[model samples]
Target: MRNILILLTAASIAACNQSSSTMNEYKWPADVKPPIAGKEPKEFIAHGDKRIDEYYWLNQREDQKVLDYLKAENTYLDTMMSGTSNLREKLYTEMKSRIKEKDESVPYKDNGYWYYSRYEEGKQYPIFCRKKETLDAPEEIMLDQNKMAEGFKYYSIGGTAVSDNNELLAFTVDSVSRRLYGLQIKNLVTGVIYPETITNVEDNDIAWAADNKTIFYVKKDITTLLGYQVWRHELGTDPAKDVLVFEEKDNRYYIGVYRTKSKKYVGIYSNMNQVSSEFRLLEANHPAGEFTIFEPRKENFQYSIEHFNNKFYVLTDWEAPNFRLMETPEASTAKENWKEVLPHRKDVYISGMVVFKNHLVLSEMKDALNQLRVINQTDHKDYYIPFSETVFAAFQNVNPDYNTNILRFSYTSMTTPRSIYDFNMDTQQRELKKQQEVLGGFKQEDYTAERLWATARDGAKVPLSLVYKKGLKKDGSNPLLLYAYGSYGYSVAPGFNSNIISLLDRGFVYAIAHVRGGQEMGRQWYDQGHLFNKKNTFYDFIDCGEYLIKEQYTSTAHLYANGGSAGGLLMGGIVNFRPDLWHGVVADVPFVDVLTTMSDPSIPLTTGEYKEWGNPADSAEYFYMRSYSPYDNVEKKAYPNMLITTGLHDSQVQYFEPAKWVARLRELNTSNNKLLFKINMDVGHGGASGRFDYLKDKAWQYAFFLALEGKLE
Candidate 1:
């Protein structure tokens, strides 16, 4: 379970006066003291194999020793990096300068109101507002997040849904950053809060039924934190009184609730990792009625349905690896009743679909590029919304209304700002609604984006998307940072990021390895990189780095690597396999302790990922996982300079994984190159909550790269 709809400040702290310490100057390979984790050996024996974990005590988060060790690590990191304070501030300022302080998202219409979110000059939170009927109407503040977040160090607002009459509003909030949210309501007309509250529900996942008073939301597993049960609640009632409508018995499957676009049915979706899925439907008009299965779940079956024109349009991988579209009458819900609407293509992957009154929009990924196609339902004339860039990402934007012929979508590339457009399907014309405002005179022409291919050991061509300053030479004189997240079939799109401009302008080349384990190259690509074939992911990344060096993009001395979460896992894998290839590495909340974590079923995502990473209880999976698990495979050898980060409250990839990892590396690593650890005591998986503050971490990381290159001034 990777969250699909998962959605950080700087300067003054970096300038804080440094306190005197034993280490007078920052030195690489210096005789410095690192925190030594206590050796409380824990024996793990399975499948006739035995191992001892010396740092296993770090997982006891509630113990005082663990907290003290983490704090000590932070202190050590700050001391080691004290010399680069100025560079950090300079980088932070430069990165922050590109952003527009006062910005508002494009307003979208839903029901009778036009809604949007805007940020003030220096505010860290968004002000959600809406106007009735027309844009000229007076702004009604739906949620003043700035005021609500006044005293909280970390805060987030989850999904917000308004009543049918547009009077009552519901939203979820999280102050601890653990993904557990508190549900609350407000009377939009009266500007008053409700008395009812729900605790420990999943983040922002609620569906309002037609009754306006009843809503459906999913409850998380108390210990594991996975959304396993769907609950129905009525307005003004105690959450304890809420009815449990559905509970997914299989731990491998996760449950979620959402209302259909046509507003006719409320759908409850239960899915396994890209393998099998089942959806149940309840008539929105009859919220109290029991939901019925659209079609029974079958082995290897995967389908997502959208209601349109008295029919259910299904996008499924049943007998079609790339997925195809089939339609069935709303009243008859069975695979036998399906009629092919769009035939499957081996080369094209239908990522998603949206149905309109007169048109149907398909988000197709071909050659690692997203393409938007609009089909006229009545005339059967289909055409693509043309894009100008050869390497860009284009997908549907916020489209709430189902009756419009104009399709709203967003397009962006490594060089282009995020551009929103409204395409008229009837007239075959596109109107630019808005483009992200990059203040301080930014231009797309200053950068270049290119796609390259690297041959893996097995001769499989791996795609790489790269961007750099215009006229960048292939000579190995520039600094290059290679990044990848080769897991869970997640496609990392080559989208624009204003912060990256700092690197490009500073003579750095950034490349993303579209390796296996991601769906960018279609289903087969992902299949080959996971489970028993997982080694392909690490091998492909290493080969890509080798390819870049062979082509003179940059030498190993100037090369760095980065990845967060599962991508952090990539960072771990690559470093373990080819430590000499990278000069520096940033592993953000890395899942380095894969073998041990997967051996337990109580961890948040471990059980559900059995299909993704095979169940280690089996002898073969255990042996295979142990062979490559980063922490398990860490050797007593010279390693790259590394900065490992973690969050105290991270639900996914617990902080201990990295904490224990740093401890073991410190004990055995033969290199004196920096091995720094920093833990955000307040936040979770997604770091700092503010927009500007998030950039501070990136600035520090870039500053680290500069320092490693001996260019810090």
Candidate 2:
């Protein structure tokens, strides 16, 4: 392999219950032992670097020993958590009690029907229903997931679309939790199912053409699992005869298909990892017509389109890092003809938009808080909906009708419940539609949320969103759990979650670090934390932990770190960099083997993520990834207590990554502190599918933390 110095110059450097069980109740029998995976070294050579992976054999999912090992780990986890069985049950019950047994979502009018979903008293799934003409009309049951999921142990209903005539329903379902949903059509009036089934397609990329019988769906790449092909299938015909509408040949882009809000055009969009995108449009009335490119793809140019009248409104980052709004004639859809409608600002980020007849609602993020800006296009005036909370998330909700005076949006915070509201864009009046019901005496006044800033090593200020019970003291004695997911420019909203009530009630401070890897602070924040500058994510998180301690919010003895997936990678980095800062760490399905995983193109997300986490084939990226990858940096010294969890069939972060990390940690760690590993046999990346079943896993996790604190009573 060649050295990186030759090409380095051109690259831009972006930037729960506890339970104290009765000692006998929770303790595992001393005879039972932890699983120790046997190693057969495999040489991985990349960028002229050779690394020996002893646990590479664990990746062989079909091997009996691998299955036995995963099962053994599960057994060990159960035995270890047995002492906290009572606490786990109590936590589960408390969490479940807070959720309303029977709940219904707010109905939003779309086309001619008011659509919504509701749950029965004890069902794990929801029943999708709709009312025609008015809310008082008879309710029609489109699909009851409770019935479709009766036989499958794991099932999920993804995106759903109704034809223009409202006679047929197109939906996707995943039975194995791998995200490969099969498309099925249902006749609403006849109450019959179409025989044709489309398999191996994406869950959220389904669109119905105006013809009602023609549908466009995205096909997932069998090997990479990337949505790369858009196919059109005619109802009643075999899926084998589906015509390929478009295929994204670029390895860097992912494909998606959807209908415009006007329902006038079906669009196919190819989004590059992060920097660019290309969109194609086809009139909905002409299902068999070719899709014309809205704008040719250009490097570092990202834009999204929405059709309105005779023009296309675009949100692009052409010359603005924070993004701006542009409009172009529908017939002359090209970058050269695009005219600026809303210029970008340095302080505010245009996150999203929802177009209406006379107004345009933009979801903006400013000062780390979401602001809903309602722009009256007719009057050329705009105003923001006010929010009282210091740390909260607000975004446009379901507003399907393109012609409406009401703008539906949602708002929530750590203490506040998820509430939906309808605001009259013309009258400037807001009406509360529905607020989430939290049973078991949950009160927003009992808790408080605040925002803090942590100064990073580079002098950059990273925002931290925190929430805790009122009347708590800043004495450095409180136990705190710092969490974050600083990757893919995905911001972790400070949203409400009823389950967290248990922790707040027990005097725990939950904090989310708005690290550089996320878009919380803007595109620059994300750019500074990715690729060669990836270490900023880890450093930002560590700084937040340190700031919490310095301000007396928590102490090193009572501090805990929690993160999953990429955030799990943060946990791994922090524990390796500053082991003494945390008492315990919970890494859920972590991506710890960065260099090795990125080097393998066969992995699910490796190929498309080359731009995000530089391709390891390049020596510069290879050395940089190895420098911080958790598995490669396991040191022969004391480490913090840790509980690592993974699922056998995870498509995102392969289960073997965490398994191998744990095995290596067991071999090198010099600490006697607790180290546990668990693998869910029946589920994938997201864990249990059932509503209550998912809480059981959480109950077990909470019990682990409580046990560490000696608070399990």
Candidate 3:
């Protein structure tokens, strides 16, 4: 689930002059001890069951004791792993070497400007710039994020919208990493920023009202951080005077505003429990007009709209579980009036679509692989854009223009660096605009990428994407890292990752388990792994690990598991289900307190996630979740070495969840194995804001695995 607060890779460590040794051989300070949290038991009685939480007191973020405990844990980790400082630095340098220090994104044309972002040679942030009319024109600096980020410890720029006249730029920024962005406007022509600012706006939810002065943005609830209200604000006016255009009374729905590619209408989208959605549309020309409901909300009904020509195209799951494309006249925008444009197929899932003057491109998924189907509007003829790699990811890119025959998309695989291309629908030709330049001496042929299938315990075939240096032998001796995020119907793509190259080059096999709970194999795949069948996700991941061991790709002595957020939940569950199967595990910002989180609607994502993980207020659902909850299932048994990470200000899964889970695991674990926790006091769910800074966290993780593998030098 993309919406689930998942941790993106980021980290850093101080330089130390120390000799590195393997975990088993490294000397530890005799007096150094792990910080033990003083527990105060709190009991919750629900559904005729009582759960005693010993570390519930850690939830107090404002408490000095909680902060001290987190700091102590960090200090303890630094002391225990201090010997691997050199190894971490080496890994960080190696990984950073692969990235081009100064790079620019492919310029995309929108409105009358060719807009793109580029980083300076040594800058930590990008500078957004544009050229008027043509690429050859003089560059116009819209926003220099590098300059804006100078004074803040953490800064992020969210959605940026250029008015229809291309003179005013509306953007959102988050300085504290809580994802509560503040909306601001800049006059590109005058080089002056507007004084009026809107606070607590949703990230990437701002849309210009064709009038240029008026804009629509979603306001987030101060407590839950849920974007529930849509507001209309006019330039030069105080934001406090803004009108509340729409308010979603249902706590189950998350709302956002976006403009159509054709610039015809602005829409307010309401996503209901990730299972259904509703949209309100208004003409972009009428800023003060009320938005009419395109379609009322329905249970289990999902649809998305695209405007082109004179009709509205909808990608809907009304009668198709895998979804299909339909078209409805602009005057009649109801489900009954919708006519099928592309019929549904059991084998293929219509994931997304893009509208243009002469072509309609559909992003479809089949057998866990992505494909782009292009259709000719005149003749209704369709064909797929071919990809040579057996396991790769290809998806639509920035194509905001509606009258162009060219389509932009990105393609990448485990071995292939991400490449951008512009395909001409009329000529059946493609031009490679740019391919990521790996600064290090990296070659595609030096590594091997292959797709393997593992049969789950229930006989379902789960796919695994593997990548390693060439000449990897199936001897069950090589160290392997398996990753997955099997929730929210979000499919993990087999895309190229420059950071993983550091692991691959170090004789480590990197693989992604396309397990259940994700829509890798289509909608049914996700349905089977969520709610009552959620355990299927855990079972499938464990089955993949067992199959890998059985096939000699790796063994219990050398196999490791890694995941963040929901995937982190997978890491926790797998270790409990089969602790002896893994040598070490890294759970990043994991959501382990499942029953407690789902039972409390006050949590950020709790109310909206009832459909994903059943409402735990019910007896059956409560018991089911408790049965597998990592924090609840900790037992007095030998467990694998683990490193858990969390952020102080994470909005997704609160830091307290991991903090509490770790405290419980320490109480019950019977093994002498290390259980280290590293909490970043500065950043939120996603670690560092800078590109290179995030690699430090990656390096920290790699060093942990290398130390366990005795590969540290």
Candidate 4:
């Protein structure tokens, strides 16, 4: 069941550090510490008699994405040949036993009504909470997943959102496509989807104009990499109601979208040779055609066009590596007309910006700790929102009906599940939502979030987040699972995950290492950890393991590391770079071979993120990527127990990467054995079926964790 860890000339726990008692300074070979333990460390985990490519077919999905490879081979591997039966069958067989059925008696999260979607037979279908009795009832309409799998009509929505006058109900039904979709409309009290014309027109995102008459959404032309066109659709009896916006020739550049706050349109369009942005005022009364362009910066990169305070605000790296923002009057023109408000002073990318009634809100990060700041539109001054040092937080939406100056957001860290709060602008009083209560019959007071530092190879301190039961001392006595993802600009925020409750209730401690690659700290934090900085992510992860030991949060023998997708890379890197520090490892759909993976540009995020991870064609970048790639780094030596998982249909991080990495590892490492692998026959990158299917995945990982290290009786 496990891909026993290969023996390696692995770097000892001491080689990773300089302390005299540290494991060892040099990398040790696998044969040096053969995996002789009955923990089954020496067995190869591959499915014997099964060709690697055979699993490819069972798991292979003929998504349009794989067309390029199939065409190159002059083969038509379309649905006509493979179909989706195998996938559905695999999911039904693998996931049915893993999760509890959607029994109406079993309650779900309090966010909505917990019941089964009888419409769908096997899926843990979305439950419809249609009381509509109170205003506070489930208002955020539509679960994106439900819409994706079950279609628009059958899915359910939470929370109700009535227009300013309650004349129209602006509800969104979330559906899945290549991306999650929102089926939106102003209900005329008909229990059916309206505007038959709009219904036939396929569009994932649907945001209503303030007047509720016009709709704003992007029309994606998937011919090229970035061929999304922003369109404005007027909801009336007229058949030809929708119109092309920005009407530009370059499909990649003519990306227009409606901004919620200012109720205006923003997008980066090209003018002659220079690429810039255009802002348009879009309300029910004010139609398209009357548009305005603002702030013509010389340089061209990714910039955000937003409407705030009845004006336009542009956040772009036109002048710096990071984002700097500026605002213009009602119709400020050109680059010179712009006045800088928030300068791009540091390294982190801008996560989000919000405008409250009285205060213009800004959430920045030294790394990724939502550093809240408020700019009084009245006084034109910036004031830091008062809050303690916390990582991964945000300013929630505002209640439009109430004129009260207030804001809301949820914040948390390694140990904290989530503490949602409503902050009043005038009174500065905070109201807690749900009060950080622990579910699945557990106690919150039992766990704590520890903000510790793990210095990387260059002495830069990487942050580590730890959550353990209150009674557990820093004696390194309990099993520890350190999780992290250090790729792209994806910030691993400090919020609560209810599913994690499963692991927490078991007396096992959970720690999230906010290493360098994450925006947890800020811009500089990510820069130091991306591309050529990639090794920093791995080293930072290793340092986190070492820090946990030094802090006595856990011992080397009880420590484990895990990550998925990009984070899966984190799992592989930590194991390869410093295998001795971890007692076990799990890599899910890992991109362990960076150079090889990156060379293949057809991957979903690969093209755009080439800017983040260097182009391997460049010798320097290739050398750097290879230095940390887990697949290339795998050496014959003593290593820890491990689990590797992948979905045959995974289009993002291909299943082949993880499969190959594990195979190579099993063949190479002769360590203490205990290596494992699981490839879901039906799934894709997520490799999950339904709700229960996903949970079963979690349970399997957790079961392995408890068996290997929880020291269960």
Better of 2 and 3 by lDDT: 3
What does candidate 1's lDDT look like per residue over 1-713, in tens digits?
A: 11111000123223433432344333332334666776878899998899889888888878877888788787667766777777789888887888888899999999989999999998888999999999999999999898999899899998898888899898999999889998898999999999988988887679999989999998988688889999999999888999999999999987789999998899999999889999999998899999999999977899999999789999999889999999999999899999998998988989999999999999998888889989999998898888777899999999989999888899999988899998888998889999998876788888899999999999999999999998988898889999999999999999998888877887889999999999898888898999999999999999999999999999999899999998888888898899999999999989999989999889987888998888988889889998889998889999999999999999999999999898889888998788989899989999988888898888778877877877664
Per-residue accuracy of model 3 over 455-490 as CA lDDT, tens digit each: 999999999999999999999998999999999999
Per-residue lDDT of 256-338 in model 4, one digit per residue for the tens? 34335443443334321112444444443455544445543333554555565556666765675557777766566455667
Question: Residue 106 of model 4: what lDDT?
Answer: 16
What is residue 147's positional error in candidate 2, in angstroms? 1.3
lDDT accuracy of residue 698 in candidate 3: 89
Instruction: Report the C-alpha displacement of residue 392, candidate 2, in angstroms.
Output: 1.2
Candidate 4 or 3, higher TM-score: 3
Kindly list the per-residue Cα lDDT of model 2 for residues 283-378, writing each as its tens digit: 999999999999989989999988888898999999999999999998998889999999999988888898988999888887778889999878
User: After superposing candidate 1, which stretches have Cα over 4 Å from the reference?
Assistant: 1-29
lDDT (Cα, 0-100) at 499 in candidate 1: 86
lDDT of each: 0.88, 0.87, 0.90, 0.55
> After TM-score superposition, what is the CA distance of residue 609 in candidate 3 from its true location, in Å?
0.8
TM-score of each: 0.96, 0.96, 0.97, 0.71
State which candidate has the highest lDDT: 3
